[model samples]
Target chain A: MIEVENIEDQNGLRPDGRRALELRQIRVKMGVFGQADGSAYIEQGNTKILVTVYGPHQPRGSTGRSTSNITKGIVNCQYSMAVFSLSSGERKRKPRGDRKSQERSLQLKHAMEAIIHLEIYPRSQIDIYVEALQVDGSEYCASVNAATLALIDAGIPIKNYAIGCTVTLINNPSLEDEDNALGKGVLDANYVEECTPGVTLSVVALPNNDSTSKDGLIVVAQGAGQRLHLSQFESLKARVLYGCQDIRTILDYAVREYLTEQSLPSLFHVALN
Target chain B: MEEYPPIIVRLAINRIDLNLIKNENVQPRIYTPGEEISSQPDFLRGHGTYVDDENTLRASVAGVLEKVNKLISIRPLKARYQGEIGDVIVGRITEVQQKRWKVDTNSKLDSVLLLSSVNLPGGELRRRSAEDEQTMRRYLQEGDLICAEVQSTFVDGSLSLHTRVLKYGKLSQGIMLKVSPALIKRKKTHFHNLESGASLILGNNGYIWIGANKQDSDRSEGGFTQDLSRIPQINREVCARLRNCILILAQCNIQLTDTSVTYAYEESMKYKINELLEPEIMIDVSLLTHQRLIQQ
Candidate 1:
């Protein structure tokens, strides 16, 4: 069995050579698909995901019949993984329609519903599709982040940036004696570390720009693996919130850069002046 | 046998410059969703904004802010076409319902085209009888394209379209291209007859139709007549070239107007029509056209 202490070295670096609170590198590209109303591609370290957003148009299929209330729009989501996405070199039998994928689809739909202003688009529906091309760890977190970018690309009205992050609490026996007031919790756990005897919590939050509060408004949070102590939950939540805030800054910068590059040359005069 | 070409791979880098507008003195203020735009209570909120519990006006989309006197709104870079009254649009028929046909106008909702609003084949002032209602499908099927004007909007924001004018009705023998609706500039006339013997319709919904120019007599058939005859080879070539030129302009973030499209077509004549599909050549032609437009 791999001990929790072995996941981090003596110099306080994790097995991936990252500090406890350091998140993996993230690269984002918006409007990758011309056919989709909005599309985005994101690479969070080794985890790659492509998300597409369609509609706010006429609802069709099962979504069309469920629209009994025309007062607000409906949000539909589908989460699927590629057949060869597993890192263990094992091919999967099916890409989707499994129980796990369906549960993830429902969870993603709820997260998107909290951020989108559905009331404005009455009698319409917005469909978000997330495809995981590669999965290392934190797949659900990366999907939420990529779906947010796709929604922005489609120009859908959202309340704020919905960022997803994972926090893991590693109980170190050696460090327990030295000032254990704040438990040791890592920001992002990879595949190897995810298998450790620790608790990993996936959090989706809507981060605001206000600096007064360090914690963002949590939209969805699901905990897995071993049980977590009550005292360490507060610190783990704070660390994950901070990670979400950092990601929001990066996404906001990318959005601004993309806008500056894509805006028409003639419209600059009217906007800048 | 032809020689196999060498495949080249390189690191990913943004070839296009990040700073497009060279003027360093002025910068546009862009607002993202949930960012507070104004805290003043008196300012009227427009589209792309909502009032929060704190009474502050916040932006609902990521785009540049537009303020007209007391009204402030944010215009996103791209979105579904929002119909306005009297705007010309091109749409494909999706469904045939009772007394109305559903049209996919690239909008948030499918627009409705009423049978009564169309002109019958016989006369202008002819009354619509039970026979006219029964044969509505024969006039327009499910998959036909039509040019029409926005008559009004329903309470749910879906548009009601009308083809009452002689120039509006079933479009035939044309090439349709879909681009982003934001790329189309609003002008007094959306229809243009190019000096190159082709006619173009720059629909506000970003559906461009390129076809041969028709004579005045052909349009007198009450707008329901379809010209099934084959267009000449030369006219087809001109239409194809114009279609490529318009697409290049749209890809380069240039506005689609008759003058800009004409400039692009003239500048693109140095290369073949297929060459314009290449990325580098597309940028080169659009750059020249952009310079000429600025000079005008």
Candidate 2:
């Protein structure tokens, strides 16, 4: 097991023979459901995410955690795992009420709230549920990205877009931990590279803003080890910004295709019928 | 920046990865927005849209425009949940466990039907026997459309259902339509079956059972279109009719409710009230269910 660590040496060649910044093939399907306002399923690298959107309807449960602006909508999020959605033999179907899912749900809610224009539909709710059927690495990132697409599919408005990605530093023994987090970074680490013992940073970014909003710069800027220097943190943040930009580009393409396919329902009947 | 080989090239060269290559990557304008996408036929959704300086790229549909520099796309999905706290969804029994029947809501997850929640025959609310108490498979077999309620949601995302209401039991007659689970919008309550003909309830979890109700009237009188005697049998011709009804509703995007039966589902004789009916409606009546709807 230890030998599998650092499968991608300093040569920057991934175990799968890809580059540091390269993403695995993404297969996206839009409007897979006939009943959802907007829904999407995306397979990124080894991770798979299915996002469904509900609402812009009268709110349920207690209100006022959000305000009375009738123009925007309240976005409710549920991040879950299917009972049969285990990826590898080593992985168990994540327990439904687990803390990770709960925490991730709140984190996603906070991050998405910043992007979506919630003031438009007061007393109403827009539910965006993301189910990770297969988790490899960057599962959080996959959920955020998929939810964004589903939100777009649902036609929800956003002030600006939010995208998430993760970076893992392989920890060069010779080089100090301080120096590595700076630029010797791995962009979008996969399961194998991610498992390498080192500092991992999860970031959610708004690509187009040039990051004008203070908190808007990174929706999430959490690092998994004790601490890192501010400058090194800045480097990691910068890398995420680039990932966000790259993701924005991909998302843009996907939305265009979805819109194009949606205008004609005939094609669906022809194919599925 | 760390230098690396072109991963896209490696992917492009790998015949195996080609299977995973998105349709949009293979073609463009054909995959452009407005539902007439000629390429990447299965492109799904991307992100933002791009317009040239001239503002030519327009999103023709009513969805969010996802563009990448100059690329554009859109796909629509439903967003409303109309069911109330205690609304009943008449679903087909799809799976059966020891004590529960799982029904598909036409939503993302299957709704549940607790055996205890159901009112057994002879008015006994208590468990009858291990064999008598519950063979379960005998009481509510699979493929039955039983009416149930949203008692609660399971931690794993499944809906808990109950059959406490007298009216919301197993279904009978009329053909069945099986569409994507999400189309069945949960409503405040759908209580009436307007067709006037005997209808039964069967849950989709395959637990609820249904029989025909067309017997007492048209079948006995021979005034209606379909022969009554043959209606009891679930044979090739009957199967065809059932399949036809399902296919029609699924194809036309029609919503069916208790009071919402139209010509395609049945004939004018079956409906006691005269109303303007739409083109694509049909009735689904099964045995064990038809008579139950009538006496009530």
Candidate 3:
């Protein structure tokens, strides 16, 4: 693992030399398939994810818990992976639903609910299955973007964005003299950065869609780490906010590009294949 | 008829990067005397598109619609059909029965390619004297590529084929891969062997067989070379690797087949310049895209 022992005062850049809140490149595409009502493939830096939206139709073979809501639509999510869709040298044989996938599914559902209109069509189900073809980092963020495009492809309406971002606390308090704010404010933690034992937080922010709505709701913010103070938390939140705004711009452009059928669609690493 | 001005919907590219550009690529098709384009279209039209109600023209709203006579109908997994006795179709091997294999030809049930239906190398038309059976296995195995003629369609759409001809026999050289039956039957299927160091065979049944020599590479000799420098001693493993490479190309959905694999180049052809093979831009026709629910 690569280690960054010291924080920098020069421009406050992280180890990657990125600004306090600089996100990786985001490439997206909508309606990339023939079968799905709406489908999207997104690549945030090296991480590639494909999302497909299926049905507000009746449930298929009652197995999972079904919502009693009669008028709103129910969203069914299955976050799986292709046999070889992992960064590890050896491919993952199992589909999603391992401890990691299950956790992701829940977090994904939490983030998704923030945007998808579950109240529109009652007694119906919307299935969003995301395949993480490659994981570099920010899987949750990638899934959120993919799901949004899939939803839009499915023509689903949503209230603001249900955007997600991963913020890694560069300040690994565990290492003495590891530079105060070593993991300081950074946006869009890639796989290399996320693996370090620093505190990592996944924040699903309902951004200031109206600009003035700065009193935004942090829908699903969960972090895992050692004892951490509140100031670090505040800075992290701010970084996550910046990341969300950045992602929203990419996604908004993607949706618009899809509608206008833009020639020379914006590039993506996953869909071009 | 000069009665009505035709409506053409064509889409143009503003930015080749977006891949939102649509082209009016057309090819010619063969039509049965009375077979009209099925009145029902079980597919979605991209923006600026419409399938006429009368099953005639699937016109483009803004781009050009090239008319080809060949119209393909999607068949259910089990629906079987008798081959037209001469029509070249793609299929997959479903079962290898005694001296025969049941091939799924994108129809109900499967089609049969009997051992006797294939031609023996060295041009002999004799019945299988036990030695022939051993030789046939060496030439055409359980999952080998042999272009056979549909001899007949039996009780349940089971088709019998015959390939005792010069054009049909064991395939050698080159490589092959398996994909969704939908891809094989795509109207503009690429089969012309392009840039071939070998030859390939695409069995309507799922088996893809390839050979090394131009004879092994099948008919698209131009794709291969005459500048052999010398008769390069082709090994069996190299032949297999070439097959694997072609398979990878298919998995990538690059579409290189024994029939439609022609390399096209044009001054305006942006295929190379645009980095078109990137996975992000290619629209894989998936089962999920049909979800019409606009998320609210």
Candidate 4:
């Protein structure tokens, strides 16, 4: 693992020179691959993830779950990382079917299931396959964001965008020396800070249509590393929630731009009338 | 053998605007998922919409809002084909079942081509028997492509297809191009024999078939028997050109009608057939075709 010490220099900036709550630059391209029903590629900081959505179509062949329902559909998700994704002059032997990838896959399904209206496509199954081409930090966050774009491109009906963001507590000696308030939390942690010996919380949030909940609706939240003090949980959750809302706005804008680019004059006329 | 042109790839910058042909005032209102469309109790929710906890009807997919009377729906720009009755489709056999063959028409579910709905090797009125069920694989095995019409729809939403007509049957020696189903305009006829010596079937499900022109006199065997004979080079070129033409129009989001396709092909004659794959040439051809359509 890379060195985790001195995450923030004396200037009160993270090693990447980002402020405490600054998110990495995000670039997204939808319908990147023509073969899939819907596909997207998202790059957040140094992490890049590609996602392809196959179907809300009939489940093919006979299987353990052969009984097609009349009311709801099934969500099948697969998460795989490229062999060269986590390179430190070393290669990964297996890309998928490992314990870590399987767990992430389950987490993604839960996030996706929350927003997708499964009842609309009864007796069908929607397959979401995500590949991490590059993994710096917050792999799961990038995966969820990429998958959401893929679902949007596929035109799958969803209640909301399932946005993911990770927040980590800064334990760097420089930050603690500066002031007590600096230790509260840091938003959108990179790989080194995530691997540090403090609490790192991963959150999957859905920005509510209304402002009733300040933190939006948290679909999934999991903490890694050392145990966190009960007092810090609320602030960390709020920070991550705000990060998710920011991401949702970016994604929404990208989707609208894509729609306008693809629409023809006749389609515009049809919509206008 | 004729020499082929090398493929050239390039980027397009400041190209034609897709909305160039329309009136300036026709800017479609766009909607995103979870965006509220209406909170009124009188408006009924339709496909691509669901009522949230507060009884607000919200869009489920990002696209444009469509309303018919009191029913409001959002039509996404791209999605899996939603099958409708009377739609002409080209599909590949995915499975051979007891008395039906499962066809993949890019729909929500695999469509069914029942034995009773098909014209047997003998004739259209031939009665299907248990022997026919046993020989189903021989008639239409897995991976065999066919053209058919949607006879009806099942309760589960899967399409029930028929090939009783002479024109609809096992397809051979053609190239299949898939595109977004929204681009294919539903018309009185989906089949077209272009003046350029190629036959095309623009499946409503977005699976297009371009084949060598076949004569009506060769309609024996209920259009089942495969014509393994070689397709002339000129006819093959025509099919290839038509395939590229449909793709270019689709890439530009132009409506895929027979007229648009023929116009695109006519405009593309200045460039080599292989050159049509180039990005700039494709835009040029589609743009010219769009101009012609607008002038009409």
Per-residue lDDT for B209-287 in model 3, tens only? 5545544334232111222334355444445444434333343333334432322111113322232233332222110
Error of 3 at A234 (Å): 2.3
Model 4 per-residue lDDT tens digits across residues B1-296: 99777765445554344334334555578899988898888898988999987799999998898889998999887889888888999999998988999999998889999988988877656788899899888889899999999999988788999998888999888799998888887899998888897788999999999878553456667767887888889888888888889888888778898899999999999998888987768878988998999899
DockQ of 1: 0.60
Root-mean-square deviation (CA) per prediction? 3.0, 16.1, 17.5, 2.8
- For all predicted structures, in order, the TM-scores are 0.93, 0.50, 0.46, 0.93
lDDT of 2 by residue, B103-127 (tens): 7565334567777777665554555
Residue B161 miss distance in model 2 (angstroms): 30
Model 1: pairs clashing at backbone N, Cα or C within 3 Å: none
Model 3 residue B134 CA deviation (Å) reads: 58
Instruction: Report how far residue A75 has shifted in candidate 4, in Å.
Output: 2.0
lDDT of 3: 0.53
TM-score of chain A of each: 0.91, 0.83, 0.83, 0.91
- Model 3 chain A weakest lDDT span, ten residues long: A262-271
Error of 3 at B198 (Å): 43
For candidate 2 chain A, which ten residues in a row score worst on lDDT? A264-273
Regions more than 4 Å wrong, model 3: A3-12, A63-67, A173-183, A212-223, A262-273, B1-296
Instruction: Write the residue-wise lDDT of candidate 2 on A148-198 in tens digits.
Output: 777766666554456778876666454444443323666777776666656
